[model samples]
Target: MLNRERYRGRLIDHIGLVVRDFAASKAFYTAVFKALNIPIGGSDERNLWADELFISTSDSDEVEGHLTGRIHLAFQAQDRAMVDAFYRAAMAQGGRDNGAPGERSYHPGYYAAFVLDPDGNNIEAVFRGASERSAAAVRIRY
Candidate 1:
């Protein structure tokens, strides 16, 4: 099994996106995050040392030379309610709904919501714990 502390310790400091238009991508991400109530981590126009960068390009430009593809990214949710809220917020911000908040059997009580960012990147908000039923039984909301 994975080391729980190590996994939890390596919190996602940031995420990088490569887009055709930096401004548009930034705007889209900003709006989506705002709606979800996630604070802006950081951004820059002169970031050259980053592994993933969102650079300005033309409409005809392709991601990594391909017309379209997906990059997976996820955010931590405080609880199941926050996951639901994030899903609604993302949809309100022009994100396409990919999945609704629910328990994932694969993860054994993993609750999450998913959406496609403006650049087609897969974004998710996840909460790990028992399902609402079980959680309620134990009075676990946080």
Candidate 2:
């Protein structure tokens, strides 16, 4: 069994993505996550997981020979520079740029960048200006 710990965020429990090309998706996400300063919690040939995101090949039990539809996931970044790094790393790892990093009309200091993952999922890195969080994450062990 895979030894792992869970870090819960404010609103989401977890998200799973089933991909066709596991290796490509893994490489793409690994680089992108690294740029965002998130570590790979645990992984094997069939599974890759981080804090709240779980990715698997279609052959995995959770996938059962199925593929997930394109979905959008926005990750939090420390600052605009991190968002830029995410774009650069993702581009070097087969990610397509959906949107360049910039302030959005969503609100002031809403800096973010968008990229399409190997599976065409819209992935994003966003930095919402200066703010404070209650905690880094809620830790859970199993």
Candidate 3:
């Protein structure tokens, strides 16, 4: 018999986003990361020597000048306090706040905060804990 209970999946490794101008996108992502106090892993800008490449000069051009199909990306936070800090920093760095740091009961103790990046991407920081629900309830009820 297999011991299914012993199986545990590790956290996510990394995420990728295609940008029109690598320099501009790098700067924007770097700013948000600095605000959140998350170290950037790495990035690169290389020309693809292939035929089926659809490279564009800018993100808007890549997406046909419309902010459609916005991408949502979330990062794991160490704790609720970290989530709060991330939200504050993001707002301070010109990120638009979508949701404040608090519990999302719909997700079972999910404490998260959301923000919009310079390019209108939805970014979030989240932590998992039961205390988050109680705190959220207090804020909501009061």
Candidate 4:
């Protein structure tokens, strides 16, 4: 067993973002994902991935030389403190603060922080307060 586990039934199976500069984007994302406690699943000169997100240089075959427009992507944080950590790490890695960590009216306990990635994509970390889960995720072994 490789001890692999993944949360299936997500809205998106995967998403690829083509960036103008892979090196810069890679550095920024590396720090950001670290704060989120997500591992860098794999990488090469052209692409790096963490979980469902794949980032690559525009020249990559999957990207087809097309750079994606600025988009908002929100990651789930386990708690409020993690959201703050995410903001701090992002800022340290050249991420611009779009919004500081705070609660919003989106729901009763929607705590979130936003930052613009190196490519100016809006990235957010949010904690939806305490909740229940049936299981951590679907486990797969290889």
lDDT of 4 at 76: 91
Question: Candidate 2 or 3, higher lDDT?
Answer: 2
Estimate the TM-score of every prediction: 0.59, 0.95, 0.56, 0.91
lDDT of the structure predicted as candidate 3:
0.56
Clashing pairs in 1: 20-57
Model 4: colliding residue pairs: none
| Candidate 2 residue runs with Cα over 4 Å from true position | none
Models sorted by TM-score, best on top? 2, 4, 1, 3
Please write out the lDDT profile of model 1 over residues 1-142, one tens digit for every residue: 1111111123343344556555656665666566455555345562211112233333423224433358877766668888898788777666788888898776676899888877878888898874343231121122
lDDT of each: 0.58, 0.91, 0.56, 0.87
lDDT tens digits, residue span 1-142, model 3: 1111221133432234444454544554566566555654333352111111122223433225433347788866767888888888777766788998898976787999998866677989888774432221111111
Cα lDDT tens digits, model 4, 1-142, are 1225544656688788899888888998998899989888778899988777889988887668588999899999999999999999999999999999999999999999999998999999999999997776654444
**For model 4, what is the C-alpha lDDT against the true structure?**
0.87
RMSD of candidates 1 onward, in order:
10.0, 1.2, 12.9, 2.7
Better of 1 and 3 by lDDT: 1
Q: Cα deviation in Å at residue 3, candidate 1?
A: 31
Model 2, residue 42: C-alpha shift (Å): 1.0
